[model samples]
Target chain A: DAGITQSPRHKVTETGTPVTLRCHQTENHRYMYWYRQDPGHGLRLIHYSYGVKDTDKGEVSDGYSVSRSKTEDFLLTLESATSSQTSVYFCATSTGITLQETQYFGPGTRLLVL
Target chain B: ELKVEQNPLFLSMQEGKNYTIYCNYSTTSDRLYWYRQDPGKSLESLFVLLSNGAVKQEGRLMASLDTKARLSTLHITAAVHDLSATYFCAVDSWETSGSRLTFGEGTQLTVNP
Candidate 1:
């Protein structure tokens, strides 16, 4: 509904392998965020980008990295996959015009680490 | 650090019953949000409370925020099967630059007929 799409909707990778998930948005939102959802933990932010080339670490950024080179694209990469990294990853975008605006979420990507 | 907690991690309610989900936070924040997610689906924003004593309602769901108490509540009026889903409350970290949200554990609702 927010013109957001995530690539590789589902993926399975072996431990120690590299994995990258892509989030693309057509709304040209200024703020883009990556989050991981796990049982009993709700949704935890992995990383977020405020503008092109501007990024910051979130509460759970240990095993993940993010980059945004354009307003419409944000990428999250797991340098080396691990079993603990298996979770549903979601991409969200907000206009950033005001802090009160609600974020719009993408369909989400489910990653499995074997 | 900011912490958010939601009570009754799991709830089961009968159709047409009324209930309330409570959210409590550890720090002071003016912005609070409520979201709903179906099983295996992404979250959908339901309400955004921006200030103290803010109240918003849509359909059968109503959300209120009390900045003084650092609490928020989501009330359901005459719930239905379609309302069965996991509800999450997120608090905006005012100290953060990007409006980072600290989320609660979430409350899973099961509405049966």
Candidate 2:
């Protein structure tokens, strides 16, 4: 209940197509993160933005890209969709001054690549 | 590299049963977090342990962290059907301050009547 919402709750796209998922938050949190959830692998970070226009790659950032132009919106794009990219994508926001805090997540987006 | 491992990937228990889930990490970290996710829903923050020996409890759930052992545990008392969900444990990354969170494979719990 952190006032976070993800657009396109579900999507199905073909390989080689470009797809973008949006995350919007009303809490104005300074930290926003994108993650993918898969079986056996759990949730893996794709990218994170510490502030507006500031972003960094995470452990699994190969096929994904992220951009944050405002404090309330973060976007994740898949340049070319692949079968391996089919998974549940989640967006999270955190409010912490020094990084030791719990993150609240959005409802998540389910993407299928065919 | 930071590695987090959770045991009992799947758990099934009765409403009044008690259970515990374990989480182990390969590297050192001061902070640990527990999250709960229902089917097709987003993760909900359950607990945050900031240091060694940190313990927190809410309702029927309790979480503890031991930095020296590089481990954390989530204990459930008198489980209920509503508590059925997947539980995930994450640790703070050592590379940066709150930069990344390394999560475990998650434990799926099913509470029966």
Candidate 3:
């Protein structure tokens, strides 16, 4: 554990409602990422932040948006939740160093959108 | 697009048996990581292989990489019930340095008595 935590460990919400998941890290790492794990999909990247206030879209970023205003906090928001977005979300952190900056994962948040 | 594939999605072996899990990926990448996940938990890294022919061992588990063949293997010796979990192999993206990794399908191993 690299001092990472995700809020709403388990959540169930109805569709068409907005939702936000929070990832907080105490390691002061330079990079943060949001990923979703599904039964057949393994883990798919949704978004990542390289530094404070800097973020980039990943392979599966269509329905998700993210914000990083501070070094220790990253937020993933879904404007309107959908059934397809029901999955386990994980937050990960890295130091941004080449080769050695291996990504460490958080405990993960289990979200279900009906 | 880089593709990562792992064979034998499910394995059931008796304790004390030896088995290996194979990971194959497309494209060229310099690093690969092996991680283990128990049911209802996050992934925990087990090995980080940097180059072809790189081999690392811990306890009854060993991992090796073959960059030329775009393959990596995780060998388990004297399997134990404690080793029962889902193993995943991830290849780092070539587009960025330690930016992200493409994960394999994962192999679920069960060690039975």
DockQ of 1: 0.81
Per-residue CA lDDT of candidate 1, range B1-73, in tens?
9999998899999999999999999989999999999998889999999999999999999999999999999
* Residue B57 lDDT (model 2): 97
Error of 3 at A75 (Å): 0.5
lDDT of the candidates, in the order given: 0.94, 0.93, 0.92
Per-residue lDDT of A72-91 in model 1, one digit per residue for the tens? 99999999999999999999
Could you estimate the TM-score for every candidate? 0.98, 0.96, 0.97
Candidate maximizing TM-score? 1
User: Regarding lDDT, does 1 or 2 come out ahead?
Assistant: 1
Q: Which CAPRI tier for candidate 2? A: medium
Ranking by TM-score: 1, 3, 2
**Which structure is stronger by TM-score: 2 or 3?**
3
Q: Which should have the higher lDDT, number 2 or number 3?
A: 2
Clashing residue pairs for model 2: none
Supply the TM-score for candidate 3.
Answer: 0.97
Clashes in model 1: which pairs? Answer: none
lDDT, candidate 1, at A44:
96
In model 3, pairs of residues that clash are none
> What tier of docking accuracy does candidate 1 attain?
high
Q: Residue A25 of model 3: what lDDT?
A: 99
Among all windows of 10 consecutive residues in model 1 chain B, the one with the lowest summed lDDT is: B93-102
